[model samples]
Target: MSEKKPSLLEGFKAFLMRGNVIDLAVAVVIGAAFTNIVNAVVKGVINPLVGAFGTKNLDSYSSCLKAPCEVGPDGEMQGIQIMWGSVLGATLQFLITAAVVYFLMVLPMARYLARREAQRKAKEGVQETLEVTELEVLKEIRDALVAQRAGGNAGPEGSPAPGDRG
Candidate 1:
């Protein structure tokens, strides 16, 4: 009997139910929530430290493309202004977030995974192969052949050697 094919809806449902998709969805939610914490750290800690260089808030830093960057009493600018403070703030926030994620989460998780895998391999008694040179392999093969020709009973520890008839 021919097997029935899954409908598009069923296929889509299966894809949505995959572990990675669910994990990605959860990660997106958690990342959105974690943004507040990162932002708080940047604003409360990093911003002050950076502000010691010039201003408390990066938004105050600007460059004027045209002459007379002065603003009127109504906050109307007289020339073109490059708000580099906003760029600095955004860059600082991104750097802080990346550093925190790398140091606190990514680094630790990678270390843990590496340690776990090593431990698992050790538990499974998986021995790492020695780095044998080509010459060493050739020597081993030569010794086995010599022992076989000499009939010195080197038959792979159990079976008959190469020249043996049955």
Candidate 2:
């Protein structure tokens, strides 16, 4: 008998039904929306500030050859145009994103988790100390029981019986 292949719909349904897959899909959508905001911030605020430092636009800072460079048919210089400015802009955006995520999300989350851990540790410490104290008390009780048993078996003047002497 030939094996039946799973349909695309079934595969898609399984994918969507997975917990992590659905979460990832939601995260991707949110990330895309957040990217737009970050892009606007970079283009509007950061670019102007960088431009004031003589870099004009983020797309214009590149190494270009002067005279003796090969000329195209349109009389334009034909040299290796390294678009380093775009790279710089992308790098800046990444830095900004990292900074924002760190300060806004990661830092607070870390602090909250730390506080929770500390509280848990404090609770555990108290529990462990209580257990230790209880054990100590139990040991004292056991020692008392053993002492009582020994006392009951001993002779009147704290001497052993003839048969107890070893």
Query: lDDT at 138 for candidate 2?
Result: 100
Candidate 1 residue pairs in backbone clash? none
Q: What is the lDDT, from 0 to 100, of the residue 153 in candidate 2?
A: 68
Per-candidate Cα RMSD to the true structure, in Å, reads 8.3, 5.9
Candidate 1: where are CA atoms >4 Å away? Answer: 1-8, 72-76, 126-166
- Candidate 2, 5-115: lDDT as tens digits: 999999999988989998899999988998998999999999999999886589888765444446699988687666789999999999999898899999999999999
TM-score of 2: 0.72
TM-score of each: 0.65, 0.72
The sequence of per-residue lDDT tens digits that candidate 1 reaches over residues 63-94 is: 99997899878989988889999899999899
Please tell me which predicted candidate would have the highest TM-score against the true structure. 2
